[model samples]
Structure formats: C-alpha cells, structure tokens
Target: MGRAPCCDKANVKKGPWSPEEDSRLKDFIEKYGTGGNWIALPQKAGLKRCGKSCRLRWLNYLRPNIKHGDFSDDEDKIICSLFASIGSRWSIIAAQLPGRTDNDIKNYWNTKLKKKLMGMIPSTHRKPPPFPTIPLRTTPPPPSSSLSSLYNDCSPYYTSTNSLTGLESISAAPHNFLNTSTTTSLAINCSLLQTQDILLSPLQYYPVKDSLIMFGGDQASCSSSDGSCSQISYGKEIKQEDMGLHQSHMISNGFEENQRFMFDYGHNGSDHSLNTWSSTDLKPNGYLGNTALEYDLEEVKQLISSSSNGCNSFFFNDESKTQERALYY
Candidate 1:
C-alpha cells in the first residue's frame, strides 16, 4: 500500500508563494525558528500553504544569508569533487560550500555545472577511456625455504609472531598489515615488482603503535612517518593476469558506474593537464599511470582539480574496511 501523505492536500495553497506568504514564513522563522517541526510550521505562520511547501520556500528562498544566482569556480570544483567521491550526497557537498543548500547545489549540478564540465571535453573523445595497463617487473623470488617462510620473512609489520596460514589470514588481521618501524628487504622487492599504477583514491592512514599504517586498497601501499621505506604488499595468490582484471574491475565497478555524468577527462587529452597540475602542486614524482605512495593535502587538492576538469572517478570503502580490523591492532 502507498504511504499516507505527511499533510492534507486539500485547502492548502500551492504554486508560487505570494509576497504575504513569504513575509509570514520569513518572519515566523526569524522569530520562532520553525518551532522544530516543519510539518506544523505553516499553520503557526498563518499561511495557507502546505507545510512542505512553506518549508521549501523558507529554506530555499527566505533563509537568511542564502546564496542565489551564479556559482563560483571554487564552488564548482568542490561540488564536482564531492560528487565524484561520494556520488549524489548533495547534503554533504552543500556543507563544504557556505551559503549554499543541497537544493541549490542539486539544481546547479543538473542544469549548469554538469554541462560546463561536458563542454570542457571535445565531443569526438567522449567514449570511456581504455582501462590502464600496469607492467609488473619480473623479479626472482627471494631464497626462502617455503611460501610460509617467505611471508614471514617479508611481513615484519605483522604484530602476531605466529605464522599466517595464507593470503586470507592477512585479511583476517588486515590492521597489522604494514609495520612502519622496520622495512624488510623482501617486502621492498615484492613492492617493486607489484607496481601501483592507478590513483584510485586518497591514501588513508591508521595509527598503529606510535606509527602510521597507510592503506589505499587490497594493494597494501605503506610509507613511514619519517619518509623511510615506501613498500606495498601483494597477496601471493594474485597473478599477473588477475591483477589487470582485478584493477580493471575495481576501477569499472567501484568508480565508473557511480559517475553520474557521461564525460571522462582522462580520455579527452585532459590527463596531461591533470598530470601537470599534480606534478607542479602535489610534487607527485610518479607517472600518471602510477599511484601516489603517500597521501598529502596537496594530492587532495589535485584530485578535486582533476575532478572539476572532468576526471570524475574516486575511491570508496577504504575507511569502513579499515575500521573493521580496528580490533586487531
């Protein structure tokens, strides 16, 4: 069955609000402050409008310090960045821009910002970019007696002294995945071979025993606080063929599907501009194909800038999954 309406439809004034109605809503809100219930606000304000309608009018139009008219370039960047990262969480996007409401941001995105971004890209190159190909270096496995021995030799960051059963065991205590204090030579060798060629999201950090454990995805990228030992961990089960497919799936399913707009800046020659920007501002030494080994505030600014230029892709689920293993650390 259909849910009942919040208010009576009959005898409620609709359409454009008159000056008198606007004045009453504004004055009532200014004096009484919505009385904490929008559904009961209309009658209290002596307006013939529906409570919902009155609320919309007051919030969108009559609210104090409400920003109207054109959106600034900075606001455009913030909206695009937040949208790319969080999808259509308009309220969260609105919070970043002062004097703007979720309704305003939504309307601007639908009518203006989306088109402005689309216009930045040439029409001929509108198709999705081919998935990035990362080449893995061939290195002889370290001379360890067995696979278990190798894992123990490489993973000095793990708090547990007992040998892990398998790759899945690493997942069981994902929190102790990287130790910042010590860098195992084997871990560096493994990291060098397993190239991180995609900038999927910002690098997130977790505090572990007076050290920081940096994580991005299943590929365990880490760096010490003192800027020593930038190493990433890869599961033994992950094959070269599987890495390509898995990274592609992570990009396609995790990000591309969430892109509300059809335009992709990565394909339309905008990557050069993005790369230039990141190189200059963020000082990211890695190539466009390689992900950043460390997180910086500047990288975030670059992400927002790239997003505004139409590179509408982002990383999610890093925080929740990290939190799940909080008990282990």
Candidate 2:
C-alpha cells in the first residue's frame, strides 16, 4: 500500500502566507488548540493551506514567545559547543536555548555563525605534543653522528605510549624488533651534557654495555660530580660515564657474565620529581677507560595490539603537557 495522505495536497494552497491566512490560523489555534492532530487541522480550520504549513507558521512565527533572529553571544557559544559534542542535532540544540526554534538555529548556523567560526582557525591546531619540551640551559657538544643518525632513523626500539620514566626504564631490547609483547620500548643513544648548577636534568644516562640503557636509576644513570657524569636530554646531548663501572665494579655487581641483556629499573623516577638530576663532570666513557660503548641509534617502531586495563598513572598525558609547556623548540 502507498503511504497514507496527511492531507489532500491537491486541495491545499502553497506559497507565502498572506495576512488573512495568518489571522485565521492564529484565531483557530488560540480558541481551540491543534487538537493533537496537525494532518486534519487545516481542513477543520477551513484554510486552503496544508496542515504542515499551518503548524510551521504557527510554531515558527505566530506562536507566543517564539524568538526569531538576533542570536546572542551565549547562544552562539552554546551552538558551537553542542555542534562539536553532538554534531548537528539542531532540534536538541534548540531545546537547550529557551525560545529558540530548531529551524531558525539551523539556518543561522549555515548562513552566519559558521563564517565566524572559520576565522578562529589558528585556535585549533595547538602546540606540538606527545614529547617534552627542553629548555636551553647550556650548550654541550653536538650529539655524536651515530646517535644523530639513530634519531633521524627513529628505530631499534618499541614505542610504548608510556611517558618515558628514563632511558633506564627500558626492560631490554627484544631479541629483534619483532617481539610480540605489548610492552613499548625505547632505544637510547648518548652524546653529552655540560653541567650547570641551576638546571634540573630531565634524564642523565650512560649507554648500557649490551642492554637497553636504563634511565632514572643508579645502575644506568650517570652520576653528577663524577668524572663520567653525562646526560641524554630530549633532542639534546650530554656526556655521561658508563655506570662509573670499572672492570672491578662491573665484576662486583655480577654484570660481567651478562654484559648485554634486559635492564631492570629499580625506579620510576618518582624519587627524582624534585628534578635535581644533573652532573658536573664530563668523562668520555666513565671509568671503563678507552672502552667504547656498543650503541645503536635507531628507534624501533611497533604496532600496539591492545590498550591496557591499567590503573591511573602519575605520568602526564599529551594535552596536559601541551598546556604546561612554555616553548617547544
């Protein structure tokens, strides 16, 4: 069966309402409400207009207290906010603003408010994010060419969206980059940092002999005032001694047999929140003498298979970091 008629379109008049038609429709609705059925109202009121046309004219214009045009600032803000949240649900948006009609709002947004919103283009794409900003405290020598090449390549590692606690926090490099663990990995390369008393170091680290370098710990961290004190700051360089470990020290710590393997962080840098991590001494390879570190500067990338059922972390998210940042470069 075809759709039932709401009214006889053949019998209904269409086009702009004249004064006489408006008067009659207004009088009928005031004396007797729509009686719960718009489809039959026009015929009962003896108008040559469709029930929809009568309903629209009455509700959009003739109805008592119906507001037309001249949207205020508060109203515009409401429109923009709701548009962002719910997206173009005009009728719902209309309900939030007293006396505003959905049709009026829909038209105003399309015709005028949309243009005003476009002018705020610069307001949207905020500060560069997902990385910490570094302050220029002292100019250390440029990072070594190999370390520079690693950053340029972005790899030899897993990227956990985890905000880095330290280069020292890395558990260990996978046997290769293809490890199926969801754990995020970061690869660290050392250059050097010159010491300043006032500056709080973001991280001070030494390249591990054959393991992922750990940050925020004594084992992986370069100590201040020691001859091997160095740092690996974000996008910057600091020279650090390799664990201050002499062959005797490495042997004593039982580290010689497993020269390269997983790094176990005994810390999350929580203790260093005071930010006093800095070193005054600059030694090329710490007490290891002329022994060079076996290092790779490639960042390893891996796809995250699933998100966590993890608890709330103390680490900063991307948005908060952006807001708190003073400068990115």
Candidate 3:
C-alpha cells in the first residue's frame, strides 16, 4: 500500500499560506481559542488545512504579538548557553527564552550559529595533533574490599604499601566516582582521596589542535549547579589549526566565567523591550497561553527558510552542546 496522504496531498496548499487563511486562523483563534489541541483545531475553526498544518501555520506564521526583527546580543548569549547545556531540545530551550519557538530556535542554530561555529575552523587542511593520553597511574593498585571493581580488570599499577597515593589506587575507597565518571561505578570516600579514574565527556575535553571534534560531559564543561557549561580563552600564540579546538576547551572554562557577561551584553535591550511587550499582555497565540508561547518564532522562520534551501539540521540533546562550543557563544 502507498499509505495515507496529508490533507489529500493533491490540492493541499503548500509553500506560503495566503493572508486570507492567516486571517481566518487568527480570527477564529481569537474568538473560540485553539483549545490546546491543534489536531482538532481546523474542524473547530472551520479551516481548509489539517490540524498539523494549522498548528504549524499558527506556530510559524499567524501567531501574533510576536517580537520580530534582529537577534539582540542577549539572544546570542542565551543561544550559546542554552545550546551548550541542551543539545537540541528546542521546546526546552524555548521555555528559557521568553518569546521564541522550538522551530524558530532550531532554525537559527542550524543556519546561523552552525555556520558561525564551522567558520571558526581554519581553511588549512592541517592534521590536528594527537590527543595526549592522560598519564593514569602506570600501575593500578589492588582494590580494597570496599571498592566495586571494574570488569576490565586491567591492572596497570600496583600498590607499594598499605597507604594508597590516592591517584594510583584502583579500588578508590575514598573516591566519589559519581562526581567523576558517569560511565564507571567506582566509589570512594573523598575524605580519603580523589579517584584516579576520572571520566571526561567527549565535549569537556576537546583537544585545542583539532577543530573537528568537541568532547566532554556536562560536569567536564562547568559546575553542575544549573547545567551551565564554562568557556576559556587561549592567547593568539596557539596555531590556527588548533584554535577552534583549543578555544573549545578553553571556552568551556572561560565561558562559565562570563555566563553573566554574555547575558549582560546581549540581553539588556531585549529585557527592556520584552518588558514593554509584556505590559500589553499580547499573547503570541492571541489567547491560549498564560505567557507567550514557549518557542522562538524568529528561529522557526529561519529554520523554515533553511529547510527550504536544503540546510542541515542542528538539534540539541540539551542546552549544553551549544554552550560547550566557545566561538558560538
């Protein structure tokens, strides 16, 4: 079987919607409300489009009282922070932003920010340097009875005395492994000593020489208090081939210091403008939401434009992915 069609797939209107349809959706929604469920909305609103289509139309276009125009500095900071902490949860990201949609935010990240990030990589095809293997204790000491051992059972170190150097022990009795490794379950009492087998997320530890990949976990990026990653900056002495990767690592540490900085630079104007808009109580949907819709309309427009132009998608598992990339921030 071929399968069902979306709105008959024949006369179904595609591309840009007419102003008349926009008016109908706007007027009907204004009067009767969207009732929260978009699928049944066309029937209730008496529109020619399907529910999903209606939802998209309203979310992407017709929704009014929108803040249109240029992306302010705060938007940039939020984009960086949100992307760093959350990879591609547009809805979750949109919630943090007052008047943006998931579709809109997704589009901006993919089209604009993605290009900005990739551009930071130099044109020279220099091979990135090999990542240094962190010198773990050459020999892992025997596990104490209190330690839950690794299945790998690879002992590269041996304890010399009853006293563990803390960094050389395998059975890290005093180590709080949870604070270190998300993958490994080695427990230790921090009061005794720090665990040697610290696990770093692919994002947390990108080698500065390689602009091709960023690696590390959320903790590796910054303090886990609010899921914000940090950013660090290296001087110009670093080679161009390594700047992107180097900046990526430094950014995680450095950016954390300037989390408030990005906001202060980018958002002060937006905050004032938003407060003015908020005074009107002009809802994006015009009726249904308590606050404005939790999505970025501008981001949605950009996404639609990019998709129409055959652009790649930039999604987040959460906000951390974007925040981890320093240049983008």
For all predicted structures, in order, the TM-scores are 0.42, 0.37, 0.37
For 1-329, candidate 1 gives per-residue lDDT tens digits of 99998788887888998888888888887777766677888888888788778777766677655678887654664465445444455654554555576788888887655544332222355552233322221453333223223222222221123332222212222242233223110110011111211112222223222222222223221211111113332122223333233235434543223321111111111222221211123113222223312322233333445545543343323443232122112
Best by lDDT: 1
**Residue 150 lDDT, candidate 1, scale 0-100:** 26
Cα lDDT over the full model 1: 0.40
Residue 93 Cα positional deviation in candidate 3, in Å, after optimal superposition: 1.3
Per-residue C-alpha lDDT of model 2 across residues 1-329, encoded as one tens digit per residue:
99987778888899999999988988888878788777788888889988788878876667665677698755665564344322354655565555666678878876655534432122347654344333321433233323223222332121222221212212222332213222221222211101100011222333433323333222211111111122211221212222222223333442222222111121122231121111211132211112233232211110000101121111123442331121110
lDDT of each: 0.40, 0.38, 0.36
Q: Tell me model 3's lDDT, rounded to 2 decimals.
A: 0.36
Clashes of each: 1, 22, 62
In model 3, where is the ten-residue run with the lowest total lDDT?
260-269
Error of 3 at 97 (Å): 1.5
Better of 1 and 2 by TM-score: 1
Best by TM-score: 1
Better of 1 and 3 by TM-score: 1
List residue ranges in candidate 2 displaced over 4 A.
Answer: 120-329
